[model samples]
Target: MNKLKNKVMLRGALSMLLLAGLGFHSFAQKKNWQNLDLQKDSVFGIDTEKAYEELLKGKKSAPVLVGVLDGGVDINHEDLKRVIWVNKKEKAGNGKDDDKNGYIDDVNGWNFLGSAKGSVSHEALELTRILRRDKAKFENVTAAIVKPADSAAFNQYLKAKIDFEKQTDEAKNAVANIGGLKTVLDSMVKKMGKEKPELADFQNFKAESSIEDRLKRIMVSQLQNSTFEAFYSSQIVKGLEHYQDQLDYNLNPDFDPRPELVGDNYADSQQRNYGSNDVKGPDASHGTHVSGIIAADRTNTIGIQGVADNVMIMGVRAVPDGDERDKDVANSIRYAVANGAKVLNMSFGKGYSWDKKAVDEAVKYAVSKDVLLVQAAGNDNKNLDVEKSFPDRRYEDGGVASSYIVVGASGPNDDKTLKADFSNYGKTTVDVFAPGVQIYSTVPDNKYEAYNGTSMASPVVAGLAALIRSYYPKLTAVQVKEIILKSVVKVNHNVDIEMEEGIAPKSVPFADLCITGGIVNAYEALKLAATYK
Candidate 1:
């Protein structure tokens, strides 16, 4: 198979918009819907609150360290500052290697994406990186010019080139299609003088000019499908940014920032001793949100309660705005395991691996150290059985990582619409499903927002793992993984899943999507963990 490149970011903007549209009326008012019990709330959440109330009520638990390996985190945020892991041996502001772990002043954690000079915000995707290296050799070279030995390399180049062009053109087209949609929607909202303007607002209304009439028609058409607030947030506010990212960094072939910013011997996979201590870099929105999901301060009466209590979050900055390098990922894993993280929540993934051997070695180390790893399956709707998602549980050698758990996204609905439309599924690839759609969590600058992705789903499972490890300290990583998988609440009904926009809904048995044919039940998992001792 040709090397797979990340589609980059979560898929299904329109579907997310539609979901937002349906729930926008109560979106801001909703709090911790992902923690609600199915019997009590009708929302198929992780049952975290119930577990806390019934099972964990008078139980003293140890503080477990959960590593957040992602872009960056706002460690100083009021919700996260209290729970951030501090390196006891390392003194702050000494500017010297106190712990002597090859990182300086790593009070919280390390940043593999940064150098002593600064850190990187944007970089080329693996697709662009591969194309950049091979474009010079294969731009005009024909099949006949290629040696039989180089045939595989040449085929990979051709596929990468085609995908790069196709993605760029699609991004350009989307930008052109709805460039000024937010402005138009803002104008309509102002004109209507209401929070949620109905479709009938323009039925008897008059437009000031011919151009105004066209814009009004556009708004009306969108309103016919979704509410005004939902359409505004999902389609215009989010859609434009998605395509802009593609144009600026993700799909841009010429943009290379590693040379100036990171300054690492990227070609050498073992150059792990070069990054700085700035765990929170230029962007921390994604990482902060993920951290908050795992363990935000519970007693602070802040934004939202995390899935686990008595937890310390270690921030390891590795993933950038674009695709993460395999070297950084491997280093992040080793760093976390060495620094005493019992569980690691990896909410980032890509479609390609630059060096499989390097990443595989780090994963093996984590397994050997008995550190539990939870990862997001992917956002693409494609079945992982046929497709590829990087940093998976599968090792390059023979056996799979026992402690690694791959999570897919699930919604709050108890009916047929439980599966998140964009979640990548595989009976073999994905180990479990968790609450991911419209997942409310903490962001940067003491803020909170709901994000949609497997990124959100992975943390829910990781949080549960941390909770299990904290309460039942005797349980091993593999044991915790078994408890999580075995205690899931299996759904019996067949779900009519919408695979694509125009196609009919594909009715798949809930068991056919993931290995555990069910949603993760926090209450049940904790109950089962009690007997393990």
Candidate 2:
């Protein structure tokens, strides 16, 4: 009996060894083929040899279009010049809507923001919109009597009221705390004789052995000590102003701002006869960065290579730094579909969506038109499966609506635990994870920067999506999504991921975090696309 038990254990150990060996072998082979390092030679991220193989597979001739919906795209950037999508129907500088799309001479794409010239943050806009809506209602009637007829409006009004009150309270606290901290930092800045000092200066200040050591150490260590003082005071002012904008703007859902801007009802996305063709909207940084990630003129030995080569980037300036109105996003999708965009990359999102029905229908429209929507999973570091964020495919209703692929942030390391700290994750809500941390991509005005977020990660997948469509146009957007999801190489190694707030940090399987359980691999995706062809 003892010998039989020993043999059983030995056999089980051997079987496990065999399985592990096979898994390692398969992983190595996939990595070798997909991530063949092009760092030394190719300016683009593509493995030139694999690209040649894909070209031979009849993918080189595809004229695929990718629409960028973000802040704005710099139309004149050297790397982005040739690939900019031109409105073939409209004559440039004509000031006439030749295509009759309601946008006057939209030679590139429509700018939803009127005369874009300043920066706007979605956070700032959301706070402003929220506060504005509540301020008006609270002023007209007391909170006791402020009961909105519409359930959605009433819910939003209630949320806005809570948010403004919290922000106001937080800002007030920050302002009070900052003054005491500022006295210490002001002395450090004066002593350093520089606005910005190096780590050495900080260390020197900390080396002091005096009664004021703790105070000096705190001042030099956290830049926030001084920076927070400057910004916190501003927040208090903005918070108050935000409260006022809420009252003045009547952000009430019933009160539409479209007529104020274009003198038309914005609730109707079918009313495509709005917008102007001025593609280079007020702020160009975010859109340009997203565009560069999708197709920023590769192999020119210039800025970074976008995801695909044979690609045209359609600039849709619908999302400003502020909260994107549903009207703009819906119209942008319609425009991209009408004009010839195969893939639409939306790198922006917000918690509050006043006009969800309009956005949902627009996503449905994009799916019907065979356009893929690649969206960011957001950056709040919360689990999206529990917390709701907009621009998602699945509505509160149990219907699967459109061809939307939501992406989360991943690190270059194969370890499953290194998922970005801020990436929102869900098995159902998040489709996949890709390289979003410190991604070096294109920026406006002939520049580049390494920005980190699921925002950056979504574009990486979108670029790969463009590559798949370019190589395999026959594959439906749905098919492309499936192929990408299935082709991902799953890693078994335990990795340390940054966890959500107040959670004990531990390791988990990479597959447990997201749907695809894989990173974006251009080489692998293209190979799959080739097989489909």
Candidate 3:
């Protein structure tokens, strides 16, 4: 972890030096560049508005159902309510499965993480669970005691234990440090007799001693050109809450928040019909944001317009706050395909997968049903061809799924800083890139916020797939995937990009980062889809 941090810092420094050399203030401005016009503004957006204005004008298309597999979705959000997919077969608020589809009253799609009582907000990491589950069996056992056939499982257990300990300790220390900083800030605010102290207050503060001077300097630097309230609200408060959540729920192996709420046997993959119909579980922010990016109201003049116009978003709540289980992911894919979803957007992934075969089977099922699966290529900034990320395109028998597409995140900047610093990339594993940084989308309660991750990139492609499927209704899922991969706008230049944050920037051919070697373009894809046989 320290090596990774150092690499990130070095990359950041190099990026700063490069920016200074180029006389650019920053690599990219802090605006919604993902929605900008490509040709007119020179921004690397998907040209959604342009496509609608020129290419897709007066074109009649059918509605495409896009399944959003993530941490729930706000079905009733003002920008998303009318665009949500409703189960016409199952009646709403009924106490029975009206459609006889094994799920009861799935009005706005099913919530695999919900229960009759409530839902969970956090969960232990996959490695933490693996460590806890195998502790008693492998506590004092060595290689001599293990059979040759079981050696691989034992090695995996050892690795999981090491990662669990290291990650938990780091999370605890971060929480403590942030909590202490908040205390100091609170004291300073109280002494100033102001809830929101300006930078001038910190500058004018008199330090009677060395300790006071040190504290004053820290506060001044942190709150420079900003109000104390604003700094606390945006940085300290949110940082504290995030680290605390990691310590209390994500890294704690002894904690299990699912037993009481989601009374399903988690170890049993066959027990699928245990969750409730509450698709909007405890946290709907991630799924809502992705859904809004795909199918938010375009003509309402309320929030931002989505990429695809004639689309229905099906909320499949399978991902939790922490790592999602493979069983739920498999079930979510199966459920989406069974319920007539044409495109499925999976915005969540983890490093470890316990049931890869089940997920592979589900992928096969979706492929057979002609459902396109779009996946995020993680945010680790590592090469996905080397490091493993779950729900990948590879099957158990060394065959790749043709219907699946893995997307990396692309930033707003052109040339050198085109790829997002945190996005994972690989020439073989990553299919293409899309705008994922500072993407403004609908959150819960009809609100909007900008979030960054490859999670945001995957849905952009899924929405494009929906657009293609809606307009060219005869194209299969594999055909749509091929069209997207083949019709990318090739960036024919070398660029300096940080494969990992904190590492020094490396100059590589921009085409080597992804298979397509170009960013996904909506207009180009639409044009190509029109000519497809």
Tens digits of per-residue lDDT for model 1 on 1-533? 01111232324433233323222212332468788888998788989999999999999999999999998889999899999999998999989888888888999999988787799887777878889888888888899889888798788788878878987887786676556445555676678787777889865457776545765665666666567676666656667876787789888878988887788888999887878889999988889989988898888887899999999999999888788888999999999999999999888777777787899999999999999999998877769998877987788787888899999888888777788877889998899999887778898899987777788888999999999999999999999999999999998888767755457889889899999999998999999999996
Per TM-score, what order, best first? 1, 3, 2
The TM-score of candidate 1 is 0.90
The C-alpha TM-scores of every prediction are: 0.90, 0.76, 0.90
lDDT at position 525, candidate 2: 67
For candidate 2, give the lDDT: 0.63
Which model is ahead, 2 or 3, in terms of lDDT?
3
Please give the distance, in angstroms, between residue 460's alpha carbon in candidate 3 and its true position after superposition: 0.8
Looking at model 3, the pairs that clash are 7-502, 7-503, 8-501, 8-502, 8-503, 9-502, 11-502, 11-503
Estimate every model's Cα lDDT from 0 to 1: 0.82, 0.63, 0.80
Q: What digit string (tens of lDDT, one per residue) describes model 3 on residues 1-533?
A: 10011112122221232223211112234344665566788888988777898899999999999999988899899999999999999888768899999999988888887688888768877887787788887888898898788788799898888878887776676666656656665777678888788778878877665544665665576564445664566556666666677678777878888888888888887676878888888878889989988888887989888889999999998888788888889999999999999999998777777888889989999999999999988877888889888887899878989899999988886778788887889999999999987688999998997677788888899999999999999999999999999989898887666643356789888899999999998888899999989
- RMSD (CA, angstroms), candidate 1: 4.1
lDDT over C-alpha atoms for residue 155 of model 2: 60
Candidate 2, residues 1-533: lDDT per residue as tens digits? 00001111112121222222211001111211222333543222234345555543543558788988877789888888988888788888876778876677778777665532333322234545655556565545544565556445656667767765665554444334334334544566577786766545666764333423654444344443334343323332443343344333323334334444445465465666655556776667677777777787865988666767788888887775346777777778887888888899988887776566777888887899888899988776667888877766876455775578888876544444357656778877788877665566677778875555677777777888887887677999988988778766565566555553345666767676788776666666667776774
Location of the lowest summed lDDT over 10 successive residues in candidate 1: 1-10
